[model samples]
Target: MITVPDESGIVPFLRAGPPPDRTRHEGWKRWQDQRDKFIPAPRLSLEEYAALSPRRRALHDLHRTATHVNLGLLETPMSAKVTKLMRGRLRNNALNFEPGTRDGLMVSGGGYLGKTETACDAAATFEALWRDLHRQLLPGPIPGTRDLFVPVAYCRTPVRATPKGLCAAILDFYAAPHPKTLHGMVRQVADSIRVHHTTALLLDDVTRLRLHREDDQDTLDLIRELMDLNVTLVLIGVDIPNSGLLRGGRPDPRTGQWILPPVKPGQTFNPGAATQTERRFDLVDLDPFDYDSPKGIKAWLDHLAGIEDRLRLLQARPGMLTEGAMPEYLFRRTGGIVGLLRRLIEDGCTEAIDSQAEELTVDLLAGIPIRLGNLADRDPTAGEIPEIPEDIAVPAPAPRPRRKGRNTVFDDRGERPAADA
Candidate 1:
């Protein structure tokens, strides 16, 4: 005879348990430390700066100061927007996740504008929050369960951006084997995501997806399927219009050609037939740094000061280099692009060190092998600095031809007559 358990007898097991002791849990402690690792860099004391080696000191000050500015205040608005969208999706999933309801974020920017880094930072924050929420709701591992529940899944978009490839990538993130067929892979990915209880998915470099391909529609549909499982999607890519991720028409399978949206003369091309999945994304553009802005100028000054402080400890003072026409010169040369500015500074530092200059000067900077172009007239009143010395011209490297397919070896003799055949 078997005993049957009553509701009253099982009440303790079914009731919500007390919160787990976070300090005692090694996993939670590790996660807490990881979250705290991204704290803003604090200013170093004089003695501390003096103790670092010359190379370490230079590289540290350069990266820490520059990255702090670019990734901190300048990126706050975009970061907040991403966070709001992600949190809203999470809330919707908890409350009422309707079918065909997919809220996504699209981060677009020019090349080298730090869009990838910004998206990654946002993803890290979301993962941390997800971990905290899981701990609160579920407390700890379930009895007889060997796998850990991962709420956030972040991955780069597949290079060959087909529907099958994307599904396989997601399955790979969950450490699940996928079937060879496209439909099979999709089913496996959906099952893995559900089993893992994933709440969000971040795909970076989505520009790799080809436009006007039949598979593109399949990829979009797969994304909708993922969203139906309550996963918030975030895509990061370059600001290219109509790359199939957004603002593009699908290929017509019958004709095997693109079915582009028609537009009248003088009217902008707008696709009125976008599916709910394509229209659900909220687009955010990350602009390059404005060197003319007061805030931007201050950021430059802070970076230079950081470099100077570190250099001073090595007995090579970069006095007054951060002032006068130097900032204007840097802005004109690099056009306020963060990546270009970093390269200019790194190369300039190397030149200064090689020349044994006690103080970095305007002349020393002009000599660095930097490719200068037409400068933007963002600030007319900033006034002209001395023309970059004519002799400082470093010829830009020749552009490489874009690779299309397999490598080809050309004959030395051009176009040999086919008459011999």
Candidate 2:
């Protein structure tokens, strides 16, 4: 007979350690390096700007508008729904613990729909809010704690979603060791969550959990247990055949009882009745950006202009424009997906710079490979051109006059002085 480890071993694993302070951690540096390419809008005073070198100042003006575009997702209807569900969870969980509450948010979308990014952004916002609240309530650092409190925890679902694997993922997030058995792992995870005061958990790529039908109930049960502990779970993944949580369980005709697919004898399954976990989630679908609508085109152009505005503030040049038919062409090519649009713009810009072109042209964008969706045969101009928004429309720049002589000098103030003729 196999002897289980005593509860003491499990108890030690559950003891809450200090929350992670990412700012001082090595991972913080990795994050900074990854995002270093995108220049954020500077909040420094004029005096601070005056102190930087020309190169540094130039770099400061070079903004990655893609981030701004990503941020714009918050304005979408899907995001509003997600926000409402999350707020409800926070409010309800704070007042009283509701077991198996309808607190989970399911974000489903196609590839390149920015589902993962949106979920991550939402998680970050929640975590920041939690940190601020913690600081306000407990100004003094807790002795022996790395962080005051962790309001949110974000992790990707494991490739093989076993009960032990899921528990190990949570443990790894908190830098804790896990016991070999599923029962011990669950206890440790639940305890760690309580000790850290984690109110919300975001799991990306949840589709990975459905690989094995036998483990489906185990995964769902784990989620239910987390919910019972008052942890609001946000599940993000690409579109799946059925609801990510409630797939594969069917009703038995003879017994009139719901039965999940058979699992190995020792494997864990949901002890509760079937269809119980289905009610715990609020599903939110993220559709691709609508490039055909006036509002959609306006949003796309405004995102680019927002980045240009930052550069203009620092006397730097603009990149993309809104004044011509180029917007319509871009909309048709990218089919309104944010990821494709970003890639198209970035590749076009690189090509233009390499070819010494001052502005992005239709010819430049046409050269980039279309690897995303099947748009090879689709004509960008086949559909009706979306009417440009009145406020967003600007008259195209007047063509520069040709110089009469080779030696004529074009002044900084736009005056073209004649040569010594």
Candidate 3:
């Protein structure tokens, strides 16, 4: 429904739109916004839609655009793996009430590989369950205290990250006070986590940390100390393993796995000492979708199918994206990157809705430019459909059951106990 008119007509609607993209979305308030936003475009019967007035229909069209564009990040096998591993670690840490340092999780991947979204998704889910179990309240709050039981804190490793800046970022999440001294700030961080009953700490964009800098090394040390705060520290960044984030710790010669000598809780490590974090974190790399093997091909197809099912185009065919060369065409265009595929589909859907094409075609996608990240080769033949392996056949997902309209015309209510509503 359109908003009521003011002194002017519906011009107010046109005046407002989403804010600047540069605004950080990792804050608690902004993160909650992302978590709670889900607006499904209405699937109206042709007759029902035709009955709307011109203004109402136009407003509906505006709604359709908003819904399609922000359909939200779809779950893929990649996000599932991250969520499972992360939640498992968080649960494990929560159960360990002993004094030893809790282990953490690191999600490493290329840019636009849905690393932050996956980590955040898992964190948010864990927070919801935690809140429910605690009845949405932290136990034993001082009377009349306005404390928020945050459960999860998300922060980006500063662009020019340092130990103090890192501490500030965590404190900033809770609007906790910052101290002038690095030691004081670190103390504030631990105290804040305890006060808020935070269970998971997500430090994203860790690739920005440079091991060569002394302040960066101190920051790494601070991160390990934060782990002892009894929260599962989840480090998310682009190409973390290669980013020198796991430096200082040496890999075992025989086992060929990262290892470090354990440090006692509350003890600071020598700047040159082996990183206490390397052995404690289960570092998982999130790879982009693969199209080379049978299993890989099936995963790619399944991903496309998931997107296809969510499409609200009135004229969309059942297999608009899953069937024929479209999937492969999309794969080539996106290079199996989830972010790129989403952009391609969202843009295509927008075009389809406005043009009345009602379905995605190769030509429509061809006209749509996908901004493959800075690294792509920009190959001309990318738009050309390549043949996928013939053997692996992926079955389409079962169509979801539609909800039957209610019979509101029935006269009997509670008076007729035997009749269905």
The C-alpha lDDT values of all candidates are 0.54, 0.55, 0.70
| Every candidate's CA RMSD | 24.0, 15.2, 14.4
Model 1, range 131-244, lDDT digits (tens) per residue? 778789887887997546766666666655677788776776676887987767766776776787776677766776665666655565555455545567777676634454
How well does each candidate superpose onto the true structure, as a TM-score? 0.58, 0.63, 0.76
Q: How does candidate 1 score on lDDT?
A: 0.54
Candidate 1 ranges beyond 4 A from true positions: 1-100, 142-147, 240-244, 248-279, 292-322, 346-421
lDDT string for model 3 (1-421, tens) is 2333223335333324554221122345455545545556677666766787777777666666666666677877887888888888887787678764677778887766888778877777777677677874535556887546777888877777788888888887787888998778878888888887787888887777778888887787777767656788888877776778776666657654455444455557333333454446777878889889999999988888877777777777788888877887787777787877787788888898788887788878777776443433212221212222223233344587999988789655555455553
Q: Pick the candidate with the highest TM-score.
A: 3
- Pairs that clash in candidate 2: 18-146
lDDT of 2 by residue, 1-421 (tens): 1111132323211214543333222342233234323333444445665676765444433332222332233345555565665666554665565455435667776656677666655566555666666788878577886763556666766655777777776777777778877777787877787887878777666666554476755775666556555677777776643544545555446643333333333443333322244334556777655766778667777755553453223223454555556666666676666566666665655455345463466666666764444544222321112222222233354588897776536545654567733
Which 10-residue span in candidate 1 carries the lowest summed lDDT?
Answer: 377-386
Sort all candidates by TM-score, best to worst. Answer: 3, 2, 1
Against the true structure, candidate 2 has what lDDT?
0.55
After the best TM-score superposition of candidate 3, give how far the Cα of residue 272 lies from its true spot, in angstroms: 19
Q: Which regions of candidate 3 are displaced past 4 Å?
A: 1-37, 45-48, 136-144, 250-257, 260-279, 372-421
